[model samples]
Target: MPADGIIAHLRTLTHDEHVEVAGVGQGRRVFRVDGVEIDVIHRDLGRHHVGQCGSCALRDRCVEGFWALRVDHAGGVQPCLLRDDLRLGVSRLLGDPAGLASAVAEHVAAFTEGTL
Candidate 1:
């Protein structure tokens, strides 16, 4: 199933839902399930796309792309789809937990700044 379909099913199972489109742009949604709040980002690759790549000046304005690494069946790690030259083996990704965390933090910081 597509991500949006999965999200829709999850939303049905959840007890509550909310739409957040202010600081976070218009590409996020929140849900509460079993007393736990789950933040789900709806990738709006449609009209709200903010950039051509991750490092574009408008990177932070997008919430529909590159929220996590894509790993294939053979452990091919694709960090970004737009870059066209970024791919790491799963072993390499597993060997650098700190590096992954730092990268995630940097992206989060950028998103937060855009939201703010």
Candidate 2:
């Protein structure tokens, strides 16, 4: 899909989701879903930048910049995009809002079950 398509899809998926914006221009977007907190940290791909990142072509995925979504679970932080299953699942969710809610619920279950 095109960059715009992905952006639109993401907007649709997160439209009703609870979110908390943090930091300045390039900040973090914390999304709360089913008691699970997903922190999406924005990346500033500029002169000074550091962190593990995904290969999504849409350089500016969010308002700040490119983002990396990680789930805050009981055990530890689970990288949402780094894992193949999650990446694919998220892609699927972005494309279909009707299924997005259920998909998120499933993700929560998987996370709590230690399968994600």
TM-score of each: 0.40, 0.26
Task: Tell me the lDDT of candidate 1.
Answer: 0.55
Q: Write the per-residue lDDT of candidate 2 for residues 21-85, one digit (tens) a residue.
A: 43222444444545565555434322111222223343244334223345433322233433434
In candidate 2, how many Å is residue 20 off? Answer: 14
The TM-score, computed over Cα atoms with residue i paired to residue i, of candidate 2 is: 0.26
Off by over 4 Å in 2: 1-86
User: What's every prediction's RMSD, in angstroms?
Assistant: 6.9, 13.4
Off by over 4 Å in 1: 1-15, 21-26, 36-51, 54-63, 81-84, 99-116
**In candidate 1, how many Å is residue 111 off?**
13
Q: Candidate 1 lDDT, tens digit per residue, 68-108? A: 55667775555355443455445555668897667555544
Q: Which of the numbered candidates is closest to the native, going by highest TM-score?
A: 1
At residue 44, give the lDDT of candidate 1.
Answer: 53
